[model samples]
Target: MSADGGPVARHSPARAAVRENDTVRSSLEPAGAPEPIGSMLARNAARFGEKAAVRHRSGEGWSELTWARLALDAARLARFMEDAGLRAGERAAVISRNRAEMIVTELAVMGLGAVYVPIFAGYGTEEIGRLLEHAAPRVLFAGGPEELEKVPLDRRPEVVVDYSGRASGGAVPFAEALARAAFSDPGDAEVRRFLERAAAVDPFEPCLMMYTSGTTGRQKGVLLTHDNMLSQQRALSMLWDVSENDRFLSYLPWHHSFGGIFEKTTALYNGALLTLDDSLGKDFDRLLENWKEVKPTVYFSVPKVYQQLYDHVVTHPEQEREVFHEELRFVFTAAAPLPESISRFFADRKIPVLEGWGLTETSPCCTITDMAESRSIPGVVGYPIPGVAIRIAEDGEILVRGPNVMRGYFRDEEATRKALPGDGWFHTGDLGEFYGKALKLVSRKDRVFKLLNAEKVVPTLLENKLAGMNPYIRHVIVVGSGQDFLAALIFPNYYLIRERFGDDIERAEREVRESLRKTIEAFNAEHPVKYERIRAFAVVSRELTVDDEELTPSLKVRVKNVLDRNEPVIDAIYDPSSDCDCRFLRKVFRLVPDSRKCFLGKDKTLDQCHTCGRVVFAEGAPGVGEGSVG
Candidate 1:
């Protein structure tokens, strides 16, 4: 802690601070070489033939898929698609969660040079229908009857393959499709034709059409080619040393690039065994059980999963050895900034915490944290990986140019033009600055809002700080925009609050609010900048949910949806006369005149009010208590 009460950015081993440089491009040159995804799979199948290529929980135990089997199955599936009229350059969509079949479908579609479009499994019937119409895939692979039902009978593709064995709804069972396309002889005409087509596939042509997560706006289909995906693998092969001996336990959805392209591609390209985590990160107990079985060499997930693992190991010390086994190399986290505590935990265990930064259009990996150095600051997402170039725009938005960058948004030239100007640099819309050669992310360009006074506010900075302030804080959304002062809607960790304060609802709310009030005061004092410090905060009664459109499928909060849902609470914050059922931080603010002292005639400074004279006391305010406004 600094004397001013702000967090001091200290290196772990406490090394001398290096001077920040202005270099923008990656320091390392392009290493290794790119290989077509189809070719890479064939090469691996020959080298690691009969070795476990993928694993998943079977009926009572686990089932393994060998490289030879995986390649053969993918080939059979590819043949089925070709028979179903899914020709080259056509799109094939899959709506499924992580499983052994997802990879098979991926390889099948890409092997025939067809575009692979993966829809989020959590998408509603309406969203699924809309994307299916837009993608117009010749073939659709659904996880089961649930996803298959999402597509209207009239709107269903020419062929539908369901992973579930049941053959209802005109959908062929996945196994049945593979069997129908199977040939007895390896050198049969069908097999030879499939191989010839796979070799004829143009690596530069579009092989993937992934939709953006759409946290802030509607989803746009981003078209990526095989070269785009393979380039990232080439870059990582230079930095990482994983081989076929390594193991991976993955739950991240295949619909997104982080899991689909980055994690899954690494496993297949390197011949490593990737166990499909059925838990999908929702059930930690099941995940821990899988952890004991898989003992992954390199784990990749979000911070929430890491926090759960950390909490478990901290409480159950005996399980530490199993959780952090000898084969464990390093852990990678992204999608959001990781808490310093979680990074420290891994660093203490001699496991480097790797954080990467990029957009879906960049094949999701442009920069990676240096493995050689100790963990730097929490937000520093290290130097650019090999073959990628990063440039900080004058306005601070990160611009990227590389083979990994997408060709364009599918069928949306306008959107593509805006993202990728004629100059070749793709605008990432994420704001960041260089710390020496490493990139430290700020806020999303759209998330930065200006107040009525024209003072800009970066909410993510305040949000991250507030999140680390208390364990009870599950999520925080700082809102001020065009208003005189900033405020926050904080979702508390309900389990922890109930554990501490017990079942009485009102009592727990009251106690937690009081505790949060003290912490917010300290946060305000530490951040004296008027626009940065949160002047008011309300403990949100309910948690945000994906069903309510408050969060994306990847669990990213949709800020616009949050604000739209909490309009009343926001109105009440600015206008205290409005009725709102929220409990605000008590005694943290006071309505005062132009004077910098308390309106209650106490020897209190503006620091005590925490409002910095930006708020005024409205008469007959509904929740005002003495000098404070609830």
Candidate 2:
């Protein structure tokens, strides 16, 4: 198809001579090779018109839109927004879950000079209001009526278009809006106008306004240009063996840059199939059921997803191998720190999990393991990708500079100054060291704390190591900043523990503590360091949820929040006397033989410390592999 979405014309000699190799991109045929993403979309539509460009699960089954079809649909959508008075430099808010329309709307919005702000599906009215106040978008494309209702009537955009057909309350239905604006034929003047408008767009202009997940504080908007996104895709295409035929089973929330820039836009740029996990929600069971049908070549998942899948593999280990071994081209992980256990699990099966690292302000990917070029390193997220430079500060903080870096945080100059320094480097806050040529990611630079004994503790590294060894440990937070010894507040998967020790909380707690001790001991056995060891632990009964501000939307534990929330329990653990009557952490006094009559009474043994048997806390226990905790 041509730019007008009509019959294609034979390519000119110059166009035909453009590099078609996987490594040599078309834009790079002339030296400085970055182009607008809209141009890339046009190229894909022309090259592979009838090929499946996008897909989503439908009532009948999987439904796909051809490259030609998407190009036409995008044009119509752009025209509709234009007709509704959306102009260049204005903003449009996309309040939807991961869907084909969301991608289409983004591309359409980009083609116009308008930026599109992605609102993650689960945001509450207050959160939505907070975002709306910042962006003040002229148009809002809601996934459903429920999504549309989150915005106050006064806060509603000038034009409200509902993607899902099952929406009401004064919103324009998606199909009707497009039909009203669309021209019947390519020969129509309006069609020509739409094409001209798209072609006139400046690649360097701001095209994206992505909001952070706000784990630390208020969510800030990160503005990115078309060049920034297009540069990343082009740079990535050179490293990975990405072809026009590669298909992806995408489940990553599209609101984040990792999903939007890497998965969705990558598929569109390469003319590959992006099979949406239309499980209605990000239901793992439903996702697995859909997996049998899609059988994607490339898979991108967070660490938790792999942990859940590993749970299934524990019962049916070989089944997962048989399914993914031959079919999967590459399995990648990001968003949160990936446990080494999952990497080793896949590695043992000769299918490695490639890890990548980045922040939202950097188009979410500064470094990625090139599956074709480099060997997999379990914990290290590989070398920096092309066009990106990495430097380590004196404090071990990773600093990055690249075309993919955002222009700045939208309307937040203070944040922009602190994050993206005037020196042109963005402070990643993540600590990393070079392992030969590859980068080995350590814990956050700020999260590292010194114990009262003057020993340094990287909490996340210790947490990941412990979590890796145990199956029942859901989450662990190492707490010992300016304290004598390290202690952990553990959150176990209570359902599984309850199944093993039915209705017996005391027995279950004891067994879990014993099991956790064994696991952490195994980890310490591998390392000879005494200061890195965790001395004691207290298991929490309740689960952590984003609702309770325990976990971020990406499901990362907010350590400060956790620490602040459990300050009393943490203080109680470090108390000098064993007589404290704290609810969360209590002391079990070591009774003498005479006192045993009151403590253990007739059940007291000669060898065992009878009072210790009743205690939930593992107090001042020496490190089994090294030395004492204090």
Candidate 3:
């Protein structure tokens, strides 16, 4: 495996030309010319032939699809798409999870000069409708009935193919569609014609539309050109040293840029073997079961998965953590800010969890911590990619300008113009600061709030601080606008709560709430009035997930949804005496000689409050204490 755990493939012409032109300082590419996406697949097929290109978990066992088979299947699908009247430049939508068939569909769509539009599998009917209206795909591929249900039977595309047999609404089976085209003669002439047209495509012509994970408003379809994808892929390939021998186990949704440009295109460009695992939450056991069998060289996952792995390793310390470390040469954490604690946990085991920063607009990877480099800063997102330029604005927003930047938001010129400035710098809504050579993301611009006292506070920072207080606290969203104090909506980890109180929902909830109250009091005692204080809060019974519409694809909190759902609780926080269920509130009183002297449990009088039974210090009396109200 290469240093970054990708394949050890030869250099493409693009890398060669870039190196010859002295665009990149690294000499990581092999001696060969660059090929377009389709041509690159053909080259890999010719060279690797029978090598496993993809492995998928089936009912009986894991099935392998060789490079030659993948190419042939893709070619058959491409011909079928053509026969179904999918015209050049029209879009082909894949509404599915991470699966082997999804990969083939993408290749087939690109081979026929059609733009690929991947809708997230977790999207609801309304969300899917917005994308379908914008992309207007001629062919739609659904994973199963749940995904197909989002598309009205009469409103679906002309050609609808279902990979899983769960769909019985007259949709064509994926295998049957491929078989129909497989019997016909290979359309080399037609394939070449499409390739020629694709080659003629300009660097700025739209090739894909990836919808942004809508956290604030309606999702915007990001229009990414061939150059956008290729540019990011080339930069990443060189940085990570990707090659044909690398094996990647993909569990992230292919609809997102993380899966599309990074996992899919990067794997294809470098001739890497990509094993598809659509079962994210459901099939994680299957993944752990197959980890030794698959032995993926490079792995990319969100912070939550790593947290789970860390928890598992900690719980079973007798089992060697180094085994997991040795299996992966490079592991990347994206889609959310990885906690310093988690980073340290992996570091202790000699496993580096390199945190990266990017968005859908930049084809998802702009900054990555180098695996070879030992400079692992806790919160910084490391240096920018080879061809990418990063600039910190006066107001702390990070601006990026590179070939990887999207062409624009599809058919939304106003938003495109607003997001991508005239100076070529795309204003990332994320606020960041340059800490040495690396950039530390502070918070999103939208997430920054101005209090009624006119003090600006970044909620993410506070949220992070709160999350670090307890493991059971899955996520916390701070809300304070035109209010005297900040309040939070907490989502407790259901599994942890269940484990703590087996088969007793009410008792589990009460224990979780009391634990959260104690954490809040602890936080209040540690910091000052502005940052450390969360006056009131409520505990949510269930943890937020992508399916619940409370988290983005990257697993960040959906602030708007949380606020909408807990408006009543928020209103009750400000009106403390209101007939609200403020039963979770608790007081931790430390009666010191002076309030200023009390600093994170510094010198204090110790007595219990009569009313609340909270530890308190009396002002003058020795045994009796002034009650601290909740």
Candidate 4:
């Protein structure tokens, strides 16, 4: 039986009915039955006072914070925040790279019953403005000056606090704040009162405003409460055993659910050691280096990270096997359905890869494959976790009712109504099926483009970027819906190509590929956002025509026909092993740093990025190989 496949054992008296009812899929441990994370922090501090709660890298070397010290510091920060006039349920934003201060500041804010809005540190001025406008935080807690700098002058918060002690534009240093909170007069009447406020926080009150990439062209705030998050700990406890002895290597974004609930909160609740993703200036390889130093037993990452590890393992087979041997208990992956090959690769080395599926609305995890389940099944997302009931709607969309479900979208009753259609059934827009007992995803109901990480992608914006890249690129349609990376079906401006590079069709093809390659490379460099990068593309020589069922009456490219017509070619690009031959409708495109320079006949040549696929184009006349593409 899967970890989810267990008889109900623990719950409150009110939920005892849920435990007995076969219809209500109650968790093995009653959801929302355990104390909140705030209490867990207190429990952990008392239980494991001297033990290191977390580890990170400073300018000099590695640094750590003991549980007792972390609790004290967090409490101090909360007291300092209370002195700064931050009231309960108020909002606070934290913009920082992956660092220890991120966790410290977040926990501190949450402890004081304030909402913690975690924005991606690298967000540009526009993104920063949008989030600030919605959140309207009382005080902005940032890592350093650079983070505060990202906020546009017009959208600056009322109070800016640099938790990293870096000075920038009217922001107070964290050290100063802490010192003031500590050195206040012993007779100050408000100190004890404020500490009492922090201690008397309600577990069900909304404490997090996790914003999701709005599919409808605006960011939506998903409100998570203490009870919603607390339920996550007890729910997943049935699957993976997080012990005080266990160490977790965390690099996933803290704003994202997997990192926040699975690793961060899990670490605190279990009194385990959490090693931050101290990559030292965006150098992800530093994570691998740190892993060697702190061999964590349990590791959690997204599909992208696992894919990157696959690349490393392939590049350095011996070293990878040495690092990922049997010592590592579990490497949990979610955010997207992983290719079976990845699960097999780790399995071959005696390392287990646990695949899971969830949305930001569900505290990030709903169905996670445990020891009983196998990732070998391609689309499996495992059975619904304990205390979560899954039912399919008439239109095939997945409907979930669970304690992990969020209260609602912040200040958007309409969206909340649409998402949670009352009677406790929340509409999860994703289509799912049961592969026996496990939940296997099918497709999405809406046109919202979710990349490998479930982050929404704007189709029109990406298509425009590609079309503007090369003059020879006439029509570009971004495909790979619900897949790992984006791929494009491009219609070449053959007339312009021939006019520029002579009427030799063969020469034109080579030059077109070269120009297309350069355009993609520039795009990758300029606006290389995660989950939206074009890792592969295909070019078709035959002009798209309405008569040929490729373009619509208004001359717009018909997406369905284009995809259906180029199904083999698209499949060939993503999964080349099935095709086995390097033959496509026109040409295959892949993005990489170094490409192999291949020579066509008559001293002409084009470079092929070998890393993107399993096949290579035949070194022949490119013009003659159009409609009869093999």
Which has the greatest TM-score?
1
Compared with the true structure, what per-residue lDDT tens digits does model 1 show for residues 266-363? 88887888999888988777888899988888788987788778767776789899998766777888888777777788888888778888888999
Q: Write the per-residue lDDT of candidate 4 for residues 67-114, one digit (tens) a residue.
A: 766666676677777777787789988887677776767778888888
Order the candidates by lDDT, highest first: 1, 2, 3, 4
Q: Which runs of model 2 end up more than 4 angstroms from their true locations? A: 1-32, 184-196, 280-282, 370-379, 493-511, 524-528, 575-630
Computed on alpha carbons, the lDDT of every model, listed in order, comes to 0.76, 0.70, 0.69, 0.67
Q: What clash pairs does model 3 have?
A: 7-243, 7-246, 8-243, 9-243, 9-244, 11-30, 12-34, 13-33, 13-34
Question: Best candidate, lDDT-wise?
Answer: 1
Q: Of the candidates numbered 2 and 4, which has the greater TM-score value? A: 2
Q: After superposition, how far is residue 115 of candidate 3 from its true place, in Å?
A: 0.7
Q: Show where candidate 1 strays beyond 4 Å.
A: 1-23, 184-193, 495-511, 581-630
Candidate 3, residues 1-630, lDDT tens digits: the string is 564544433332223222212122223322233334576666677788788888887776878888777777777887788899886678889888778887788777776667889888778888788678777889889999888988865568778889886688788899888888634333355444444544454445677888988789888989887777777776765555767777787777777777667776767777778877645644545656556567777787877777666665665566544437465666778877666677777676666567778999998877776554445554577667656767777888888877778888988999998898698799889888766555677999988887788877788878877887787777878888776567777777665555457799667655765677678778878876644377656554456777778888767678898687666456444542233322332222222223233312223444433333444333433321222223
For model 2, the local distance difference test gives 0.70
Q: Write the per-residue lDDT of candidate 2 for residues 1-630, one digit (tens) a residue.
A: 212232221211112212222111112211247677678766776788788888887787778888777667778888888889998889999888888888778878888878989987677888888898889999998999889888877788778999987788778988887788647553456544555566567878898998887666678999988888878776665555556667788877788877877777777776778898866324667877777678777778777777766665665656685456455666788877666666767766655466778888888777766443334454577656666777777777888877888899898999999998798788877887766555677887778899998988888788877776787888889889998667788788654565467799678766776687677667657878877766656666567776677876677787778888876556545553233223444222221122222221112223222333333323233322111111
Return model 2's CA RMSD, one decimal.
Answer: 7.9
Q: Is candidate 1 or candidate 3 better by TM-score?
A: 1
Question: How many clashing residue pairs, candidate 3?
Answer: 9
Better of 2 and 3 by lDDT: 2
Estimate candidate 3's RMSD in Å.
6.7
Please report how far candidate 4 places residue 143 from its true position, in Å: 1.8
